[model samples]
Target: MTDFPFLGILTLLPLVGAIVVALIPRRNGELAKTIAFVWSLAVLVLTIVMWVAFKVGGDRFQFHESYAWIPSWDARFTFAADGIALVMLMLIAVLTPVVILASWHDVESSPDGAKRSVPTYFALLLAFEFTMIGVFAAADVFLFYAFFEVMLIPMYFIIGSFGGPRRQYAAVKFFLYSLVGGLFMLASVIGLWVVGGHTFDFAKLVESVNSIDQNTARWLFLGFFVAFAVKAPFFPFHTWLPDAGGAAPAGAAALLVGVMDKVGTFGILRYCLPLFPEASRWFAPAALVLAVIGIIYAALLAVGQNDLKRLVSYTSIAHFGFIGIGIFAFTTQAGTGAVLYMVNHGLATGLLFIVVGMYVARRKSSLVSDFGGAGKLTPVLAGVLLFAGLASLALPGTAPFVSEFLVLIGTFSVHKAYAVIATAGIILAAAYALWLVQRTTQGTLNPALEEIPAMRKDITLREKVVVAPLILLLILLGFYPKPVIDVINPAVQATMQDVGKTDPGPTSVVANGGAR
Candidate 1:
């Protein structure tokens, strides 16, 4: 009931757990697994408590914590949670434990009787959680950049150490892309600090940054935007995502792509728009175009993919395109839809990876052709897969429907032509989604696959536990979006207001549906 800085405690708990797991003797793999699960679960519980305690009616940051860390340089130990941060926090809190469970049996051994299996994996995963939460909770620009940059390490190791054949290549490529972006973001951070009269506190910086020259601000904004876009893996920068997702383990892919990737678009919404309002408006048209192109391009690619995992990866690229469009479009509905899309995409995408992992575990392959008639052989798994796929494709009554509808509605107001073009992506989505289902679940049983018995009778109780919340969330949020929208709308409206007053003539017509 106390209004103390509970959010900071939630953020630190996982870091404590990670340290403990890393220190545990390597031989104690079972012990390490149990401890990691408990720690991740505890963080989840604390997050839920924070969510319940959060004041949704408040129109500003809450649980604010600030301390002077480097006063001479104008930096501070600062953290806070606004509605946007809360949603991202909840996404990370819910998904990390599920991913840990999915990787339960993935403990590996080095040669010479070294027993370093699950401890390393668990430690790195928890470390990633710490950084992910830090990104969302940070109230200081320098702290946010530090967390954002540092997150690359654990992810790099996870993919490189435990991924498929091309693991090394994928890991290196992912790291290089992220590192280059991070460096650029650092430059932007420094520029912002300087522009804001040497203050790194995000709220103060936002207030003082108004006087920055338009040209310099635009470049600085792009520096930050590029880093997030690379993370989001937007369009051309997205080449790394498929390779990374294709090569990584299912649990790693789920967290990396599902929750981590959202940080990119989230950054655009949280920082780029608010801090550089003029730049955002100035660049909106171009950003919208790229988003539309990415939507169609990635969807088409998904349709052509033979690898189930790769196809899902491509599908995410398309989903992100919609999110990016929504952010740059800058309408209240579009912005709120973008936030909801992040949550929905995380759940739906996470579920997809979990099901795909199960299938891969049995078939020893991720190829679509290798999975024929799986529905007949395993009804429960097939049913969950079907549900997951439908939810992903935005089936009505599922989570993504409302978000997608909002994005389209929001975009129609400002970018009607692009929205019309982007509508085709929905049709393309149906094609690829249905194709994935048919290829794996509906066809006649393959002779090679038929010889192998279904390893699992149905989704494991654990599997059901993992998916049920997400499925429930998808359904609940799709219909009862008000709870989320209420918190999100005020934030989005405030951001839009920061970008400058909205004109009811062309701007409103284009952004809200009047012109369209």
Candidate 2:
């Protein structure tokens, strides 16, 4: 099983699909969509097979493959997955097909007169999937950086070519922000290669970087951290996200908020902490402050958003704050919770974004003020919207609740002040999410919606098919997180070992027994 090059095949399959999709005749638009969807489905099935075959007790980096690439720079075409990467891969697989289906008529609805091409759009989507897989699966530092940078191209085209009226502006902003971040990462990668024995492999760098002096390690750490912070879009750097996410086609926004943004926190986990442990610990306090601030600030922003799509984007920023806290807390429980939050957030928020797109599709507006008492007309859509909102706010029965709870509990043990402050975001989340539902779905019926033929109709069979699996998984994982935790635990434990940290016990206990 280990000899099968599964990770290599998984990474390249979507790129191959993109090529095939692009070759289809331009007139055969439906054929192109079908091909793209089928290809995404195929990738999904293959990923499932790999997931089933993965052993919880196996080596940390499984399905490993490495081959010579840049001999002079001592880089290789390396690919592998720890439990963390595997779940992220699964997330990519699961979301791609759903995104394709939700985006089936996305280009047709836009009246911006840009002459969007469906093949081009779908091909770009598949190409983006290729980059998503590659970035997560790459074991070599240089290889990861390559995939990271290349991902921006397809997404940039997706937004610029097929998005809203201001798509060009949003796309350029997204590109420039990411490009600057990439430059920061590039400098770090070069520094890491030189200082850590001129090799770009992750395992080797981890061992070699230990000997470097404190100042050198912290500088390298900052280079990587700044790039990831921009990607994470923490606090001040996050301005690009609402614009880009608001202007992007809903399907792309789903991918953007749901899965792609996780890359920043993922990079922090996979690269920064392991490669520079002392720096990671030294910087943890500052990172926690930023994370906690982001939580409260982004939640407030979400509460105030007029555009529904942008509102969803703001919610994600708040969620990312929780993930950051979990990671920098430096406990296995918190780290594992962060990883789980990544997967669960993808599922919950992906469904929410797609649902918002559906609403926008019917009303031809993304504004909260544009809707009222939609439940009276389209009960099912209203119901789904409410459910998605609840999930976003971390309702007890939903998958996100489990992960969010874990993150707070884990953080409280080490950083009670940060943890206590961060919990306020949950209340703000509830306010924004429910307020969104109230503004769009409840109250007096909107007379204008009746005039729009599409608005009166409920979510169709195809839409139900798109959201059902996500709904089921959210509930399923909420109750039975053990399946995911089983695989994620080992990798997190390994990370704990790499950073030389242990879970801190309670300082004292008071009950019937006296404190020792």
Candidate 3:
């Protein structure tokens, strides 16, 4: 919408930073980390500036820039941000610095990290930062797709090179699954270009979709839907998440789930619905079914998880289910809530993953059985984990609570049966979250832990620095979600209009409680 090229510079900054990081002397690992953190902080500050400059009521998509990249294919280096994309970009900014700080000691602390290439790890983090920004900020479909596939590579290297015992296996599976999804997305992109007058401009494609038949639209929609569904990791596609989340270093996992996985839901909201409205409606029933199944299934899996990291991973699948309900419900309240949930999930689950990592780092294990009565030794750590669990379960006064409530009530009006089934996941959520808390923090101390002095030490100042902001945001958002909701409302309205659906009207009842 502007000639400012704000987004182009913004997107390019991190790639420049990545190259700078890669240039840092390999022996100066500490310097590499310091520079990476400093660079991320700079990006964060610029993001704040960008957020301040974003006139919410101005153009529907602001700070847009476009330059022809492939004139024949009609693709361009297009980038812009609506309210939804803006918030996600802000989230990427906020979390990147935190992940960098959290990974400060990652290489030095791990047993398998002897092979961890310090410069490579930090460089990849910076490079990954580049990809995350590009994916969310991209306006051209082909551009988005290119960023989409590029984002996966850095993460694959990060996990395989710097992750856990099963790093190679986890990395490969994650890559192949996502790679297959990318191919489907590729097909859809090509299909859109051909049927869409050989153009990949998003606005043009939206208009072009009308020229395509319903049958062809359905096939194209499936290509996109399957791609997102896999990335969203709905049900059967979800098996890779646990393995990857558990195997990656905690900081990386936080970014992986917090921001990267969101690309899936983001793709659904930004691309799928508007491009193929009929297909979206036709698929809503099945998507809702998958959402409910994912909610219940993933929650149950979390409850049975013995590995703390994997348990946290399962919890995300369940949360995504709630997000799916909100998005598919086709109401402003639910859609706005889904966006809010995405932000809160990043905060709450990101915190949970970090805290779990802290525990694992000290105790040298992630098993629930490896910890008991830990509160007595490290009350601060115990308390943080408990707070994180409470937030995860959508405790009445937390950020997730507000979003989850919106999602449920919104879905209830439209799909009562699915809403009820999804609500049950909350109970299952409580069981897993609280049970994980109690088993790890309360009761008799693990006999083996008493022998390890590291287990007795509480969270250090650096760790506190990492967690406090997220905790503060969770509580603040719970009490007042208006800021985010305001930005999200118009975008959701646009999407609703594009989908040709309106929020269900309220039933009229007379003063005497009679239906009118």
* Count of clashing residue pairs in every prediction: 5, 0, 0
The superposed Cα distance between candidate 2 and the true structure at residue 415, in angstroms, equals 0.7
Better of 1 and 2 by lDDT: 2
> Which tens-of-lDDT digit does each residue in 409-503 have in candidate 2?
99998889999999999999999999999999999999999899999899899999999999999999989999999999899888877887999
Better of 1 and 2 by TM-score: 2
Q: Which stretches of candidate 3 lie over 4 Å from their true place?
A: 1-3, 511-516
Clashing residue pairs found in predicted model 2: none
Per-residue lDDT tens digits for candidate 1, residues 210-317, read 799999999999999999989997888899999899988888899988999988988888899889999998988888888988999999999999988889999999
lDDT computed for candidate 2? 0.92
Model 1 residue runs over 4 Å out of place are 109-116, 454-456, 501-516
Tell me the deviation in Å of residue 462 in model 3. Answer: 0.5
Query: Relative to the true structure, how large is the alpha-carbon lDDT of every model?
Result: 0.85, 0.92, 0.90
Residue 447 of model 2, lDDT score: 96
> Any runs in candidate 2 off by more than 4 Å, and if so which?
506-516
